[model samples]
Target: MSDNFPPPPPEQPQPEPERPVPVQPSPWAAPAAPPGKQRTGLIVTLAVGGGLVVAGAVVALVYAAMSSVQDSIALPPRSETPYSEPYEEEPYEEEPYAEGPSATEADAKKDVTITACTRDPQIGWQSAKVKVVNGSSTTASYTIMMEFLDEDGVKVAEGGAGVVDLEPGASAVKKAQGLGEVPPGTTCRIGDVWRTPSDRSGS
Candidate 1:
């Protein structure tokens, strides 16, 4: 190899092919859903949640309103109301006292004495008598009326008799009879008779 002569050019090595690098796919890069479907799902979820909240609020409001109404209500007092009617009641009635026997001072052409015979009930025929006494110096006239009252105070019988121009102290005997049943609970007595029927009825 002469110095002056150029050395043979060094042999150039050929470059080796580059190896392919392994790449990892990104996790956030999934396929997107349709816009309409995504929007529909979001709307449905919100609607359900809003409906539940609204329902709860409505229930609370209703309960509060009812409670307030009940507290505000008031009732009337029972004692303030009147229970009885404002009218008068019927009157009481009783038996007649003119049904038995009586005596007067105007009978027997002289003076007579009137008296009561029996005050109690008689089994069959009942009678009372009177006596004649000449007590007055002048003639006397007698007009006597009698009534009978039973146990129940009802009028069972009544009668009357009269003696005109009796001599002084002259007496007469008279009796009354009837066919009515006597009730219990009262006693018998001879009643005085007035001249008028209205008086007798009222008595």
Candidate 2:
């Protein structure tokens, strides 16, 4: 018998003691977070920085728009002069009458004189007669204005008469008629006398 028992199973090698694997952290795995307080502080810092960048961009855009609007608008020019009050006009004053004798009074004194005046009543008219004397040296024509006065000395009617070509120092009768009735107690007087150069031959 050749020791045919399967050669006694080769002496099995004694099992080596199992060694523990060194646990190396994986490269892609997320790192373990720190304490709760430190982690909250890191998140707050990142948020504040992001907000600042966004605010800066908004401010830049607003400033550019405002600049463009200001350049496009036109403003009116300012005046250098100060304000002044309106001009006012002065009030007007009237001139007073001059003190002197009128032209008619001077002509009457130098040319003729009235000697007598009379008024007589006719059918439908009251006739006035005036006696005039030419005081000037030359032959003259005369006009006599007569006024009729009532008893109270108030004038009621007036008329005029003309004498043509009376010689110097000559007397002439001139007559006129008033159309209305002559009231009672009425008297007549010469009101005015005017004289001019005569065209007729004088005696």
Candidate 3:
């Protein structure tokens, strides 16, 4: 029996599941920055900083060198000479001056005679004993000068004495002293003698 059952409804084809739509990138999202550009900028900044450090070091070295050169070229002080040994000064010595009888004593030497010279044992003074005879016709007085002399003949002291009026041809002895501090071995002698005739008109 050929019963015609409706051919099973035309074989239905199963619809394939829809493929997943590729997600399109959203237009509102921020774009990623390039790493290369960032790295290049950092490198440039570092280079500039290193260059400044090197330049500063070079400038400092130049300044130090200039200072050293100036110090080496500077001149020393004008009075910088140093003595090797301490300076010593020499001692001064004085020479004794030579002395002799003065003009008046020289003139009187012819008229006077020195009898003796002596030094006082107690007082350390020098004295002279002189004796003179009046040769004039009238009464005369005598003025005598005595001098103390050192061994070198330097006149150390001087004194004077007077013999009052005496008759002519009379002899008188007078002692005269030289007052001063004298060196040892000092001697005294008559230096000058002046004879003056007495003036009787006023007397």
Candidate 4:
């Protein structure tokens, strides 16, 4: 019996299975960006299958919408220049005047004559140029008044100027200004004149 089975060959030595190799961990690397962020507006291709007779690919189409973007900001309104009007001085009623003119003043006004009546180009007020002659026999000073009147003779403005130390029978020119702004076609004239005697004897 032993010859027939021929004692089983001595068990051959079995080589030890190879120890699993510990693959060195690849150097730490940054993870890829999420699909939503990376795949936008891009075309992608994919393949599936190893057992089929013909090579085939699974085509998945991901549509990404594209649109134009515009940036704008609101701004405040622009500033404009303000309106301007003609200038005016104090009102005519604010002037100092008595109820009535004295006899000498009324007589002196006759000696004062208005030469030119016009509007001031710079201040836009009425003005009058008057010639005052000291017709009395003594040295005197005179204050002459100007009145601005509308076409209907309505007084609109009044002003005055003084001529001092005028000798007897001597003449002088002075400008009288109007206080208020008069209308178009308005007239200016000498309103009144008052004389002050400084010396009894002619000087």
TM-scores, one per candidate: 0.28, 0.41, 0.44, 0.46
Highest lDDT: which candidate? 3
Q: Largest TM-score belongs to which candidate?
A: 4
lDDT of 3 by residue, 94-195 (tens): 664333212343443444566777777777778777776776687767788888889999999987777777787787777787797677798776766666
Please provide the root mean square deviation of candidate 4 (C-alpha atoms, Å): 21.8
> After superposition on all CA atoms, what RMSD does each candidate show versus the true structure?
16.3, 20.5, 19.8, 21.8
Query: In candidate 3, which residue pairs get closer than 3 Å at backbone N, Cα or C atoms, i.e. clash?
Result: none
**Ranking of predictions according to lDDT:** 3, 4, 2, 1
Clashes of each: 22, 0, 0, 0
lDDT of 1 by residue, 1-203 (tens): 65698689999999999998987778889867799989999999999999999999999999999999998888665696768878887887765554333333233323333465343366432233434343546444444544556666676665555554445545556654423444443233444432211113343
Q: At residue 2, what lDDT does model 2 achieve?
A: 79
**Candidate 3 or 1, higher lDDT:** 3
* TM-score-better candidate, 2 vs 3: 3
Deviation of model 4 at 181, angstroms: 1.5
